[model samples]
Target: MANPPAVTVCLAGNVGRYKSSLPVGQLLLRGIMAGAYIAVGAALCTVAGTGVAPLLGAGFAKFIGGAVFPVGLIAIVLTGMELFTGDAMLGPLSVLQGKIGWGKVLNNWLWVYIGNLIGSLAYAYIMVWGPFTQGALGAAEPNAFGLNAVAIAVGKTLAYKSVGSIGLWSCFLAAIGCNFLVNVAIMLGITAKEFIGKFFGIWFPIMAFVATGFEHCVANMYFLPTGLWITQLFPSLVDKSTKAADGTVTYWSPLLHKFGGLTWGDVWLWNIIPATLGNIVGGMIFVGFVYYFAFRNEFPEDLMK
Candidate 1:
C-alpha cells in the first residue's frame, strides 16, 4: 500500500536529518557511489536511445531511453547512496524542520557535490576508453556510440549557445522541470511501504522527465565529460569537413564550428552552470519547501522539537 503524503514528508525530513548527521567521509563515499550509479543510467540512456529515433519513431525512442534511465536512481535509493539532486531537497528540508543547521546542509552538499564530480569523471574516462571507443586510443572516426556521445554533448552545449540568452533560459527551465519531477519520484519512493511499490513509484516520474528531454546536472556530469573525452581522443569528430552536394567540404553543425569548437567553457556556460542553478531552485524551493508547507501542520510533534 501507499504511504500518506504527511507520513512521507516526515520520513523524508528524518532521512535528511540522519544523513546530515553522518560523518563527512561516509557522505563522500556514498556520494561517489551515487554519482557512478547515475552515470550508469546516463550511459544506458545514450546507448538505448542511439539510432532509435531513426529506426522507430522519435516519441517511441524517447520512451525507450527514458524507460531505461531510472535504473541508476533505483539503485541509489534502495542501496543507500547520496545523490546531489535528491539531497538538494532533503538537506534544506531538514534545516527547515529544525533538525539540522544551515552549516550541516551546506557541508553535506559541498562534499557530496565534490565526490559526485570525481566519480562521474572516473566513469566518463572508463566509458571513453572502453565501450565508447573502437578499442584504440585514437581513431580517425568514432564508432556509432562514440558519435552519439559527441552528438549528445553538442546538443546540450553548442546547440544552446547558438540561440544566445534565450537558450540559457531554455536549459534553466528544463533543469527545473527535471529536478521537480525527480523529487516527486523520491517522495513517491518514500511513500511506498514495500520495495516493489517504491520501485514503480520512483520509476514513473524519472521516466517522464527523461522522456520529456529535461536537463539533469548529475547525469550531465557523466554525459558532458564522456563526450569531451571522446572528442579529445578523436578530434576529427569535432570539426571534420564533409563533402557537400556542391562538391565543397564544409564543417558539420555550423554553430559548432562558429563557437571555435566545444570547450569546457562552453559546457559550463551553455549547460551545466544554468542547470545547476535550476536544480537548486527546483529541488529546494519547488519540492523541499513546497512539501514542508504542504504537510507543515501534520509533522510529528517530536520532529518539531
Candidate 2:
C-alpha cells in the first residue's frame, strides 16, 4: 500500500526500531498479494464504472466497489498475507497493540505477498485475455481523435490537481491519507467484540471512501490502468497489427475494435500508473502517521518482542 503514513512511519518507527523487517523477496511477495486483494477490489470498481449508468435503478446494477470491495479486503487483512496498504498499518498495529508477534506478521506477509502477485497478474490476464478484455482495453485508449479518456477518468479523480500534473510525492501523500481512513474502518472490524456490529461499523467508512473517491492503494494496482491501458481490449477487426511485448504475434481478443476502441497500454501509462501511485501515497502517508502518532501512547509490551 505504501499508503500515506508509510514513508513517515518508515522514518518514525525506524527511530524506535519497532518496524517489521524481512528478506527482500518476502517484502516484494507481500506487496504482490496485497496488490491481488487490491486488484479484486479494482475489478469490482471497473464493473461499477461500466455497468452502473446503464444498469441504474436495477438493484443488481448497484455500484459494488464502494461497499463490497472492502469486505473482501477485510478477509485479506485478517486471513493473512502481506497486504501492502493495510500491512502498512495492520502489521505495525498488531505489534503496537500486543495482538500478534512480529514473526507472525511476517508469516501473514509472505502468503499474502504471493497471493497478491498471482491475483493482480491473474486478474490482469483475465481482463486482457478473456472475453471482456477487448472491450475493456478499447475504453482506455486515446480516441480516434487521439485523446486518452480512460486516463482522464482516473487521473482527474486521483490527482485532485491536474491531468499529468500531479507529482510522485503528491500521489504518495494523497494515497496514504485516503487509506488512513480505510485502516481505521478495518481496525473497527478487528477490535469489535461482535461480528454483526463489526460489519456494520466497517461498512460505513468503506462506503464513504468509495463514494467520496478516497483511494485504496491496492485496488489501484488493478483498476486504474488495466481498465483502460491495454490495446487488446479493442479487439482485432480494427487493428490486426498490434502485438504483445514478445512481438511474436497479433490476434483479436473478443470485441471488435471499431466498435468501442480502447487499449490497455494507453490506460496503463496515463491512468493506472498515476492512480496506482496516488492510491499508495493517499493511503500510506495521509492515513498512516495520523494514527501512529495519535495512538503512540498506547504502545503495548507484547509487540516489542
lDDT of each residue in 101-191, candidate 1, tens digit only: 9898888888888888888888888888888885876558677888888888988988899899999999999999999999999999999
Q: lDDT, candidate 2, residue 137?
A: 41
Model 2 residue runs over 4 Å out of place are 1-32, 54-64, 90-118, 131-162, 166-174, 228-230, 235-285, 300-305
> Which digits, one per residue and each the tens of the lDDT, describe model 2 over residues 1-305?
12233333333343223224554565566556666666666665555554354456433333455666666566554554456556656565545544446675566545554556566766756654543444444454423211222332334333333334554445545555566667666556554546665676567777667655545545654554453444334433334446678886553322223234444444444344554465544544455445666756654433334
TM-score of each: 0.96, 0.58
Q: State the local distance difference test value for candidate 2.
A: 0.50
Mark the regions of model 1 whose C-alpha exceeds 4 Å error after superposition: 248-250, 302-305
| Candidate number of the best TM-score | 1
Q: Give the least accurate 10-residue stretch of model 2, judged by summed lDDT.
A: 144-153
- C-alpha RMSD for every candidate: 1.5, 10.2
List, in order, the clash count of every candidate structure: 0, 55
Best-performing candidate as measured by lDDT? 1
